[model samples]
Target: IALNAWQDTPLYNDKERAALALCEKLTLSQNIDDDFYLVLAELFDQPSLVTLTVAINAINSWNRMVKMFKPTVEFNER
Candidate 1:
C-alpha cells in the first residue's frame, strides 16, 4: 500500500491520488494554474494548500542546492 502511494499508483483514495498528482505535476512542470487550485481546493483548505505549495517549493530549492553543492555524505553503520 505504501509502495503504491510512493509510486503514485492508483491504489489510494481520490484525495490522496489528487495530492500525489499535484506534487508530481508541480515537480515536473513547475507550473500550477487555476484549474489545479480548483482541484486542490476540493481536497485541502486554502491555508493548507498554501502551506503545501510552499513546502514543495522549499524542498525543490533545497534539492537544487544539494545538487549544486555536491555535499559529501558519510554514513557510519550502527
Candidate 2:
C-alpha cells in the first residue's frame, strides 16, 4: 500500500498542526532528541486518530523484515 500523509490537505494546515506534523516527520525520518520524542510521545498519546501509531508500527514491521548487506543473494545470485 502506498500510505503517506497528505500534507497539502486542508485538514492538516491549522495552527497546532504544524507542530504535530513536524514531530511526526522528525521521528519518521531520522533520530530525534529527547525533547522531541517526549513531545511526540505526548501527542501520540491521544486515543483518537491512530495514524501516528499505525505509521510507526508499519515501519517497524518492515524494518524487522528488511535485509542488510546481503551480497545480492536474493536477486543477483549465481
lDDT of each: 0.79, 0.54
Ten-residue stretch with the least lDDT total in model 1: 1-10
lDDT of 2 by residue, 5-66 (tens): 54645555343463556546645775667786566566555543356556656765665566
Best by lDDT: 1
Per-residue lDDT for 1-78 in model 1, tens only? 675456556577877776777778777975778897788899999888888878877887889999999999899999
Off by over 4 Å in 1: 1-8, 75-78
Candidate no. 2 TM-score: 0.30
Task: Output the TM-score of candidate 1.
Answer: 0.71
Give the count of colliding residue pairs in each prediction.
0, 0
Return the top candidate by TM-score: 1
